[model samples]
Target: MTARWWQKGVIYQIYPRSFQDMDGDGIGDLKGIARRLDYLAELGIDAIWISPIYPSPMADFGYDVADYRGIDPRFGTLADFDALLAAAHARGMKLLLDFVPNHSSDQHPWFIESRASRTNPKRDWYIWRDAAPGGGPPNNWISDFGGSAWQWDEATGQYYYHAFLKEQPDLNWRNPDLRAAMMDVLRFWLDRGVDGFRIDVLWHMVKAADFPDNPPNPDYRPSMGEMHSLLQLHSTDQPEIHDIAAEMRRLADCYGDRVLIGEIYLPLDRLMHYYGREQAGVHLPFNFQLIEAPWNARGLAQMIAAYEAALPPGGWPNWVLGNHDRPRIAARLGEAQARVATMLLLTLRGTPTLYYGDELGIGHVEIAADRVQDPRELREPGLGLGRDPVRTPMPWDESPNAGFTTGTPWLPLNPDWPMRNVARQAGEPGSPLMLHRRLLALRRTHAALSIGDIRLIDTEGDMLAYERHADGERLLVALNLGHDPQRFVPPRWARGACLLLSTIDDPVAGDGEALMFRPDEGMILAPQDNS
Candidate 1:
């Protein structure tokens, strides 16, 4: 139940390669992130989560890490990363790096030697199996990106498994030696003074012991299918994962104050277990209902209730509206409805994560097939496919390349950059970016907004409302998700509350007729403390 600085802090996720490019090699680098630490500090965020920056071939971007201890030359040297850490700390912000232990790049030396020959000492470091009697994979499992998860290696005359792109091979965590090596990877970064880690695909660390064949899903379809569905019973998300996580918890605890935030998209009830019994597991497991939920009052309210109820008695709750793996919130909720979604994310009873460009209300882009760089898209040409759209560069200015790089960017900038860049929006009072800044500052100023109890208030269609209370302080929040004005009767508790903030262009009296809320509008009201 102890509240650490990170537990109550807002964590901003910056995909460094797409955040900015200092050397103009088109790729975003650590120096670019250093330049933007001020921007993050200005936003009033308490922490920043930088995606993988380790040595890699960019196979799965940086997720297929080639080295666990050093930075890739493409992302700049270890010195550059050290400087970035120093800059972030100087601004009083914590840094959380992404830990991709589920897999490693086949080009990684460990995997190279493991694949070189069966007699290699590190051969058991990766999963390898001989062909069945009929000369095929031992079991059927699908890769998340596309196609079969098993890849035939003629060098070893065996099949190595990958849950994502083939170049990123799944590690054999079943081996103690491999687990120890991965633990060392954690220690290496911890020694570098990283405040924490956002553990990628944490649930997929262990697989079914028997390699059981997963049944086909009855709801299967070709359109934007979950690669997980090809196998009904996931070989991933095994019970053994908890123990692995416990070991990771022990490792993290060795370096005090460092936490492990997990990325597990399971339903709330099941997701709560990742925190482990007796608070011994991951510090926080992400609740991703917003990404996969229907954007409506009923659906969202129900998800909120479920997540709130499922949070462990003393456990912290975390919410994520969107991430690199999904469409931007602006695109999903429509540009006009984006702010309504933002209010819910910021006002909810949790430490919310704002994806890099979401504060600017950036929508998804459409990248042509020939322009696609995602390995998943390249391999599976037509599958409505490609993640390039959401992973575009952040718009920092109106200048060429949107201040992302002097040279062409790794991915094209969103064409709406002229209007959406931070430079233009930073000074605009009505811009979503400024609104986000105000909301974050408000959260920091109000104890009820930061560490408080949540109560979902009943409301009509397209309207979401809730209350956050702590000690004698109480704050009520409501949003109209549509473009047209909507009315709501003030609940008894909110009837006497004073208006604190609103996204509306024109304010309306809280006591007035119907309490109308304009489109994409939200308001925060502080209740009179009668106690």
Candidate 2:
């Protein structure tokens, strides 16, 4: 099988509201992103995945879209978006927009009409059901944000379903008209030259026909969250979702060269189904194993093996370390381990998505109680579910507001921004940002690293090693997850290999037989002949 550009490319995610601000509105805008095209191009990424920029009510931070075809005025005008798209394309970069198909903002005209009366033309556009026998929600469904998933509508005397916030109503995928309208929404963006879409919550698009209550989770724990009390069998990952995914893929196929990336969080076996029986579903199901797996070598090795083993024939893999919703990698893992994590993510056999600000080693910022803006935190406080800490403004330089805005920023910048800003790191050799650039450059130059088949290397004790090979080129990647030095001998076929790259600035010295690796380090080795 041949490979597409997306299959061998690296994607960089940008949260528009925090990336940069050109209008001094305390929020990043499309024009700010446009002005940074050169910076992104120099970062060596092939594509930019911009978080949702559509008109929204700021309820779920743009996830609850009110208008599908228009850009949010806070971000910029439609004309500004067009310019950003053109600028990205001019730099040989692709642009991916976030698409929210599972729900729409309650303020949306479609939802407003749907909830206007029981007999409205769009009454069936959203999921609505009558009260149960006694008088509460229709079923035992729970919202991800918090509380019951059903919101009672006093005017219509019915309850509407919302998998997230009450202000965001779930769309009825069962309705033919609704599906057609949603497909039209995709067309609207594709018509404007959007390279592809990252479909949010793809597995939650459809529910069971009978709307049965979810079974209780046998291993549920209180600290996990309220939604974890149930298995979500009836509310999520229903078999019918595959058909919907395939339908979306078919529509994307019509545009030729456009990709459909589904954001799904499921076990390896179940996640494979999103690839469809004949590879007709989403182009990429978005493998998030790295984000949730244990931060040790053995844990990550097993996860990579399991995921690689679970892919359907002809299905490609993708990976992510952090996103706007999760804690920064530098925060979860220390700075040293985060560097090793970067090597692992890029060296693995898959498309890698880099979160904005991660290249500069940005960690979580402290958000005060009064300054908290995440709806998840507002809904469920004290659970440490707030995402504001990781969504702080990007630090471009050591200036007021970290050069993100002239006015106040929505979220506070990390106190270390003065030394960790991009400008500072860019000027320093062997900085985290420089490491990322070097790794990306290595991938760009080596087919074996970019589109190679990965084979796990058996080893013991605090180390995980793997080999990537393609077109007669081979490379070995080994990581040390321990805090002490460890020795590793290369396989017979890999003997006499020369070091290509190392996470640490020190040279990797070997005693003619085994190589010594410093703590929290990772290295890529290539054959002496190739070197």
Candidate 3:
């Protein structure tokens, strides 16, 4: 039996605005992406998941979608997207678009009509309720981006709920009409031959039927985002979400070979249900443990073990090191360990999602205050919550704009672009790009590294070890994830094995007696004569 396309595929994420700029308008457009299809193809990713490109108000950087079925003019028209999709398909790569169903931009026609009057025919399309007895917000829910979740709409004489920015009004999935409309939006794109969708904020689409204030979180800390201030009991992740996910699954199945990727951040127990009540949920409930777990060996080991055990039967796992919203692995773990992260992600049991620019080791950049475009930062100043540092443009070469654009980029490039650009790293030995390419190539020829079963190998402090086996082929992945050097005594199962790939290209990777590992070194090894 053949595995599904998503089962063994590696997904690459592109923040389109920062990917490339062809029109020289200081923004990345669909045409610019099409121009770089060859580059991504060379990266060896099986699928490309581009962030939101739909017509949006830019309140949350494309999350506040103004029109569900139209492309944002800034990112070019539907024709450009069609061409890009075709280009990607021609290269044997799949394309996944970011789909936002939880909310719509305040400017959306539905929202406009819904807020025009309390008696508007579309008033039920959004979550609106009468203000409290004191004319305050209807509930105590808070926005994920910050502040109260309810926005007072004087024109409609009510408070409408917004889980993010006020410009992003939450849609009422309880309303059959709105659900049908969103489904049609998905159909419109599916009809255009796009491969799939990464459903944004998938768990937040449905809210408690009864309006109630969320209880204050006992564990809330000032360091955490403001949304954590409440327990979110009545705000999100409601039971009805299962049915909605099933609906989405049914729709995607209508187009054979299509996938549904959900963006969910809940704990493993809660997150697993997205796979479906009867194994009919999303094709992949994105596992973000890598992003949220501690960088230490113990933290990651425990998390990985728990996640592996929690997965539903026959559910495929995925690993994500970084994304547009999170800090880059290099930025968090330094360039050295970022290599280990790459090896770990690629050699893991399931799909691996790579963030653009990570393969070149370009991470967080210092953005000047004036050039900051993230509204979450502007709204909650001094919270150290801005995501602009990680969403900078991809550095292609040492051109004036780092070869991303002829004009000034929307945000500053990584400070080290002059040396860390992809053009230079593509040729340099032991470069981050080369390491990624080698691992990707290995994955192509080694089924044991992809679609394999994983077993935890015992190791001491600051060390993580695991085995991936399939069809009698076995490979061991060992890593020292700390600043202190460590030693690895190969298990009996790993006897007579040699290093397949190392973080620093160390020639002798567990080939002989107990080896002394350099700080932050990661290695993949195959048993002698195993293949």
Measured against the true structure, the TM-scores of the candidates, in listed sequence, are: 0.97, 0.98, 0.98
Residue-by-residue lDDT tens digits, candidate 2, 1-531 = 367889899999999999999999899999999988899998899999999999999998999999999999999999999999998998999999999999999999999999989999899999989999999999998899878999999988999999999999999999999999999999999999999999999999998888888888899886777888888899999988888888889889999999899999888888999999954899999888877778777887888888888888888999999998888899988888899999999999989999999998887688899999999998888988889988889999988888999999988888898999999999988899999999999999988888999999988788999999988888999999788888988887677798889999878878888888899889999987662
Clashing pairs in 1: none
After superposition, which runs of candidate 2 have C-alpha atoms over 4 Å from their true positions? none
**Model 3 Cα shift for residue 29 (angstroms):** 0.9
Per-residue lDDT of candidate 3, residues 1-531 (tens digit): 267888888899999999999989889989988998898888888999999999987988899899988999999999899999989999999999999999999999999999989889899999999889987998889998879999998876889999999999999999999999999999999999989999999999999998888999999997788989999878878989999999999999999999999999887899999998763899899999898787888788888899899888878898899988888999888898899889989988888999999999886687778887899888877777899998899899987889999998899889888999989998887999999989998898888888888998878988899998888898999988988888888787677777788888756634366767888898888878775
Q: TM-score winner between 2 and 3, please give it.
A: 2
What is candidate 1's lDDT per residue for 438-494, written digit by digit as tens? Answer: 889988888778887889989997788888887778888988877777887767867
RMSD of 2: 1.1
Candidate 3 worst ten-residue window by lDDT: 506-515
* Model 1, global lDDT: 0.85
TM-score: model 1 vs. ground truth: 0.97
| Clash statistics: count for each candidate | 0, 0, 1
List candidate 3 segments past 4 Å from native: 509-511
Candidate order, TM-score descending: 2, 3, 1
CA lDDT scores, all candidates in order: 0.85, 0.91, 0.89
